[model samples]
Target: MTHWPDRPICAFDLETTDRDPRIARIVTASVVVLDGDTVASRTWLLDPGIEIPEETSAIHGVTTERARAEGLEYTAGYAQIREALCEAWVRDHIVVAFNASYDLTVIDAEGRRLGLPGLATGLVFDPYVVDREMDRGREGGRTLQAVCAAYGVTLTAAHQAEADALAAGQLARALCTRFPQLADLDIMTDQAAWHAERQRNFAEYLSGLGRDASDVDPQWPIRGIA
Candidate 1:
């Protein structure tokens, strides 16, 4: 059987208007297809139909004025993004992301809000989760930038959707290469259980520290769905 890294990869990323995926609006999105030496990518900038908060704009460098002027309408742009991701899934590509729960949740919530079909989640790979699992206690920071550095992957543009997506694909490949046993795991079932356990542990840690762990969801890939 071909391992995940040897297969085509469709990595995704999003820069949004808020940290809460339930309420966040996509300001920019990217889908990067990496198949062997060939790479293809699509990116979208959406107007989000709401004010791009100053702090969020500062992070993504997408001002509300620029987005309104140059970005596609949110619903339209998001529809195209969903279509691209669905096509990737249809092609049997492994869907990859850095912190997948956030991005995928944003996509899922956006699809629901826009009345579009939901995303397929069976073959998803999150390098963040994988890294946490593989290298249990060795982390300083697990942010994409830090993980990229740890894996010797160059991330030239940190916040740009296209750059982040591409780097995530590279990071996923690097991880699979280093941890060859990862190929033996089932993406859907094993990853779901692993993520749930990881979240539960985190919640317990928070509770021990007197922090509310209620917001720490145990769902993987997507959350808050009924």
Candidate 2:
């Protein structure tokens, strides 16, 4: 059987105005397509239509002033980002993200906010969920940076959309290389099941600690629309 990373793949990442996907506005986004030895990528910087909070700017290095001057208008940039991903899907590329739920949800919410067509759910490979399933007993964080390090992949610019997107593609390839069994499973179905199970386990762990676990959603790739 052909392994996933051995085939064409598209990796995506986003930097946004807030942590909550339901309310967040996209500030930057990237899509990286890898096929054999060729790589193609597109990146977008958007005005987001609101002042980016200082803390969020600190994380992504896109200040309000900079975004206003250099970024594309939100609608134009967002449309392009959506089109890129859709094109990759049409070409049968495996779409990858580090934590797909958040990025995909950001796209979903933004599409609704702008009255644009939503990105249909497609074959998605999330390294965050895969790493948890593959190495459930490993210690330490599963941040993209940490996972990249663990897999000997270099993430040169941690929060930059293009860098993160490219690194996610590399990390997915590395993961599949390490665990060939992953290629035998159906990405959409198996990943969804794994993510749901993991979310349930984490929710139980939180409940045992007497914390509110009500917000723990098991939805994979995208969360419920708000």
Question: Each candidate's TM vs. the true structure?
Answer: 0.95, 0.95
lDDT of each: 0.89, 0.90
How many steric overlaps does candidate 1 have?
Answer: 0
TM for candidate 1 is: 0.95
Top model by lDDT, which number? 2
For model 1, residues 71-129, the per-residue Cα lDDT tens digits are: 99888898898888888887889999988899999999888888866766658999998
**Candidate 1 global lDDT:** 0.89
lDDT of 2 by residue, 129-206 (tens): 999889888888899999998999999999999999999999889999899888778877888899999899989999
Clashing pairs in 2: none
| Model 2 whole-model lDDT (C-alpha atoms) | 0.90
Predictions: Cα RMSD each: 1.4, 1.5
